[model samples]
Target: MLDYALLAALAAVLRTGSFDRAAQQLHVTPSAVSQRVKLLEERLGTVLVVRGQPCTATPAGLRLCQHVEQVSLLESELRDSLPALAPAAAPATLRIAVNADSLATWFVGAMAAAPGCLFDLVIDDQDHSAEWLRKGEVLAAVTASAAPVGGCSSHALGSLRYIATASPDYLRRHFPGGVTAQALAAAPCLTFNRKDRLQANWLQAVLGTVPSPPTHWMPSTHAFVDAALAGLGWGMNPEHLVAGHLRAGRLVELMPGRPFDVPLHWQQSRIASATLAALTRAVLQAGRAALRPAAAA
Candidate 1:
């Protein structure tokens, strides 16, 4: 028999990233949270959480959290089916991680359509959002990873195409000659953040060895494109975002025919529940309509 209180403590510490915050959430003292975690570690004979400013869970800890989440989901299902056991609290909020570009483009549309349920949206880079799911920070995620999380299922949403683009004036000033590896080394570029490698990846695909150009970080998806249109820097813009500009000859493609592809997937915990199912269905339907079926032009 596992001690659920201790398990809850472990989950809270991992989720909140601090014992103090976990204690606040659990309506207990920080000392109580610490003691429960310590006792749980002793009982299991394995350390679950590594103490730090923002704590992280070990593999064993993650497994335990997953189990707790599963049990909670099952209980929710049972409660929903049996109205007599209904809780006084509001509906459980479903937390999910999503990348910025998707949110800026097609993801919000899906979310907008998914009404009547509470959502806690976690924004992160597409490549790394899976780590949130792995750590049990989110119940679901839209990630570039094809490999599913431990207890989650994955469904392909399709490829998000990116085009290496620059405003015509910026290109003329930076590369009087055609886009070449030498010219690329000198031009400033726009990036979402330090974690964003879309620019680097696109440059590498074209230039063999990547260039080290100074970058202006515009973290917002809309701001990132706006910076490019303002001739601040060249960056990999989402194909759809640049389509109108490209057609109007405002932005020129570095590689006219070849576009970078990032295949996205909807990954969620393998629990069957009404809310999760409805959310998944809405996401898949919207994604299929919005994203490119393939990388090609």
Candidate 2:
């Protein structure tokens, strides 16, 4: 039989990333938290946490943490059904991975619609967010792939449209004649990070080949548009984010009428819990309102 108290201690330590923080959150002494973690590790005969400034969980520990979180969600559901059960001391935290672009654009609306749970968001590239789910690190993800991760259900969230934009001055200076392949090779572009492929993908789609352009690695989604407006570099900016700039001539499309639409999906574990179902409904509704139809994309 599992001692839920020991498991809770381990979960709290991992979630807070420190024994001291865990102790504060659990309303226990730091020494007690440390003792609980050590006892649980001894029982499991494995090193669950690697002690450091900010402790990290081992693979086995990660699995246990995930289990604890899922159990919490199940218990929360049960409490709702059984009024006799005492309410939890704190709201459950649901960890999810989402692309920065979606977070800057429409994901918050989905999050806001789902109440009664705190959220721990992991921002990653849309193309890679699903990896968090596959690793059991996140309960749900906003991903570019339509294929469902194993044990998870996928929902079509529609496409987020991107426009390849730059300041008018930068375009004139970089592509004097037009947006030609040769000129693109000489242009400087904005990349979100090493994992970012939006600019490259846009290049390939419009030019039929990718260019090794000089890059300015700006990681923020909003900063990408700011950099473009300042002529730091041309980049793929979200349509909704840059629509006003485009209309005001503060930004111009590199290729007029050629918008890049990246289709996004919401994937979550197929647990028969009301919490997940409620979140999924809110996500679908928000996606419908904010994104272009999946079929249209």
Candidate 3:
């Protein structure tokens, strides 16, 4: 049998990001929670969690946590097969990582359609969200790369196309003579975060060089669009998100028919569970509907 208590303690610490919070959740003293994790580490003869303001798991810790989560999900499924043993109030929750653009656009429909299962959604850049899969922090992720991580599978979900867009007022003020290299160099640009390269990519494609423009780093996808709309800076807005704005003349495209397409893939643990299968189905359906169709993947 697995060391359930030790594993639970470690998981709680990772989830809550502090031993004290984990203790409260686990209904143990803070010292007790810390001791349990220490004992597990000693027995395993490896460093697990790196203690800090927000506790983070090391690679060894990540593997253990992933194993525990997978086992829990499988066990939940087994319980479901036995109606007498299944707890009605305890539906298994899927922890997933997704890009901010997808979350802001098409992903919510999938969540809404999945009625029974709960979700813990972690938003990361599309390019980096797969790291969460490799680390086992999430059961599934919407990622940019199609290369499957070990112990995981990837499915091409389609592509989210982004257009360089700005408010009409901002465009009038910033680019009076259409998009020029000099105009772009002087214009303030909006970025989702440091990890976001869509803005830079668009700039490079347009100007033949990526200029270091004044940047407003807004991390949220919806907020990034809102910031652009509020005339803060030009940004690459996902087509689905800016469609309404474009139709209403609220936003104008700087580059028409030259959208920057970032193909997306659904990556998930190579585990058999009804919940995961269902989530994959819903996401695939919703993504196909929202984004441009790609070659079968």
Candidate 4:
């Protein structure tokens, strides 16, 4: 029989990424947690974790942690429903991984709508955030990849439209034909970082050449938007984030009707917890309302 304390320790170790941090969180000594995990691994006859600077879970460890999380959530729900339990501390928190563009645009609203739940958000590029889910760092993620990670399920959230945008003054000075490859290559460009290839990808798709402009890397999504609004250079702007600016003429959509669509997906561990279920429903509801309609036949 598996001990709940050991299971809790396993979950904590995975969550904190280190034995020392898990010990601090659990108010127990690291040695004690280590013993508990060793005992648990012996009983299960499987290697549960990879111990290093930042601890990682083995496949078995991932499964065990997911089970522990589901059990913890269920217990919390039961305690919350009881008369004297003081609401059970919000189901031990729901950790999420999301792309920066979504975080800058619609994700904050979805999070705001989640009452009585605590969230730990890990933000990364849409294409890469699902890696966190695979590593068992987050319970769910908003990702660009349609393929689910191991032991996870996924749903399409709809496409996010991005327009190549610039301030009108920047357009007048640099982009005469709105943004041909030749113009983009010569103009200064703004990007989130070196990893941000949205501009390069768009240019290649439209004009069969990559833009090798003088680049500015503003890593923060909000700051990137602000820099473009300040006419720093042309950047790919999510339609939702720039809608008001475009309408108010603070920013101009250089490509006008031409837009690129990146498909978004919601990926989550296949665990049955009311908290996760509720969060999934809320995110899907918001996605339906906020995202563009699916591609037509």
Which prediction has the highest lDDT against the true structure? 2
lDDT of 2 by residue, 17-59 (tens): 9999999999999999999999999999999999997899999
lDDT of each: 0.85, 0.92, 0.87, 0.83
In candidate 2 the C-alpha lDDT for residue 160 amounts to 96
Candidate 4 positional error at 137, Å: 1.9
**Candidate maximizing TM-score:** 2
Clashing pairs in 2: none
lDDT of 3 by residue, 1-297 (tens): 879899989988987889999999878999999899999999999989999999998888978877777777777888778968846434666889999889888999998876677787888999999999887788999999999989888989899989888999999999999888888889999988889999898878767899888899888888878988999999998888898999999999986777888899999887888889888999999998998887553
Model 2, residue 72: C-alpha shift (Å): 0.6
Order of quality (TM-score): 2, 3, 4, 1
Candidate ranking under lDDT, highest first, comes to 2, 3, 1, 4
TM-score of 1: 0.76
Q: Which stretches in model 3 have alpha-carbon errors above 4 Å?
A: 18-24, 27-32, 46-56, 84-89, 295-297
CA deviation > 4 Å runs, candidate 2: none
Q: lDDT of model 2 at residue 135?
A: 91
TM-score against truth, every candidate:
0.76, 0.96, 0.88, 0.77
For every candidate in turn, the CA RMSD to the true structure comes to 4.0, 1.4, 2.6, 4.1
Residue 59 lDDT in model 4? 87
Using lDDT as the yardstick, the better of models 1 and 4 is 1
How does model 3 fare in lDDT? 0.87
